[model samples]
Target: MKAFLPPTSYEYVTVHKVQGDDVREASDVLAAEEPLEIRVGYGPVGQREHRTISITMRTPGHDFELVAGFLLTEGIIRSRADLQGVLYCPDVQKEEERENVVRAELSPAAALDLPRLERHFYTSSSCGVCGKTSIEAVHAAGCPRLPPGGVRVPASVIHQLPERQRAAQELFEQTGGLHAAALFSPTGELRLLREDVGRHNALDKAIGAALFQDLLPLHEAVLLVSGRASFELVQKAAVAGIPVMAAVGAPSSLAVSAARNFGLTLCGFVRQQRFNIYCHEWRIS
Candidate 1:
């Protein structure tokens, strides 16, 4: 998986003189692929059997957190108790995909309104807006307000992030295709970073990493995206209890609205030593 997901930064390649002749090889970076499935189940009574709800194409790592994050953001599941376990599925059909994708099975007690998911998504990854069609739907998502306590982040801290984030991106620098997500403490020490070709995948990887490390209920940390923050990113961060969401690029209008609705601290255009805090300014120390 590490081979699939390299550091976000690029490396300098030194070409030998080769008797003054030019080299003929190209550095082609590969895209990462993995399996992610969402499942549900009943409690520890009776068969307590689980059921398969959804399966998604994804990169190979962070299978569990991706499940948890996906369920929370999709409004299917909430809290630690809502989940039984999100692990690699031994489902035999998985071999059919180009690569073996993992699945997350939930307890039988958990019910997923598939129509809710189906109505919003026509194709995978193409439909970024499902379950969030109307403003009323947004209201139903239940993040109507973000962190009640004032959280503040400093502009100086944001100005220095792009460089620091770049320093850790070994793969993106080499491949020129991956997006990155880095988690930093309030004081600004980077805790974890994940990179992938998809902006959403990058975030999924970061959240997955955090979950793998037992870093849940992440109210105290700040999440930084290498690119612009999107509505899905805001939704994911909000559900994960991430109070601050920052981006190196511009955020969509929906993202701003979602941030405000969820009481999330949304910041964008985080370069040139300047940034804009679109919502929850109190947290920008």
Candidate 2:
């Protein structure tokens, strides 16, 4: 199934390179990056509206999932019921128009927060809403402290995720320029894996897949990231109701605080059969 995804997600580039002490021409694979404009359509019956919510650079594949996950975590739409449909805005006048812009239509009863959407204009995939004054803002936007006793995972299962995640990162193996996020069952079965040039985009793609699959409130899964855990990563996991987050790299100070505040089990340096649990230790056994 992974092979069925779009191959346009990466491109081969010719480069001037050095081989040992000799200069040589080289061709390398690069993860494709392009700007995606996400728009929202919501209001009341017979009063439908549309507005551009954000523009961020991301890889070319899994775009619908990316937009869905972004809207879910941003508190724009609560669940699948709130989403009417996701479509690429059709503009016959341009060739790239359909590929570059995504529009999410909402159900009639779903209220659009205009101000919140306006604030989202400043967000980028690299640092999601990082300029906000406080973490409370995120909480106010609908992030909740994850309920405890959600799921318990064996230590051995947790140790195997990185390898499993790597097995799915075909683009990363070629370019080494992408980040990945994989979702695993409580028993450690790998469920979904997504990769993007941006770490946040990768996580969003993973969450979006779950959202589309009617797997929200991810209380029975662990999210494994290929890189450091950032505050946005924890926030996204909390919004999606994922109980545990494991990263192959270290976590930031804000990520640790957000995990503790939101009651998530976060583990870092997950390699060599040893991992450092930073919060919610009860979930690991």
TM-score of each: 0.77, 0.92
lDDT winner: 2
lDDT by residue for model 1 (166-255), tens? 888767666677788888887777887877656776776677666656787688888889988878787778767799989999998878
True-structure Cα RMSD, model 1: 5.0
Please list the residue runs of candidate 2 whose C-alpha ends up more than 4 Å from where it truly belongs after superposition: 1-3, 121-133
Q: Write the per-residue lDDT of candidate 2 for residues 1-285, one digit (tens) a residue.
A: 253458779899999898789888889989999889998888887888788878888998989999999999878888999998999898524776658899999999988878766665232335455534446777887888899676899999989999888888888888899999999998878889999989999998889889999999998889999999988898899999999999999998888888899899999999989999999999999
lDDT value, residue 274 of candidate 2: 91
Candidate 2 yields a Cα-based lDDT of 0.86
Question: Candidate 1 — which residues are off by over 4 angstroms?
Answer: 1-23, 34-55, 94-99, 108-111, 120-135, 142-144
lDDT: worst 10-residue window of model 1: 1-10
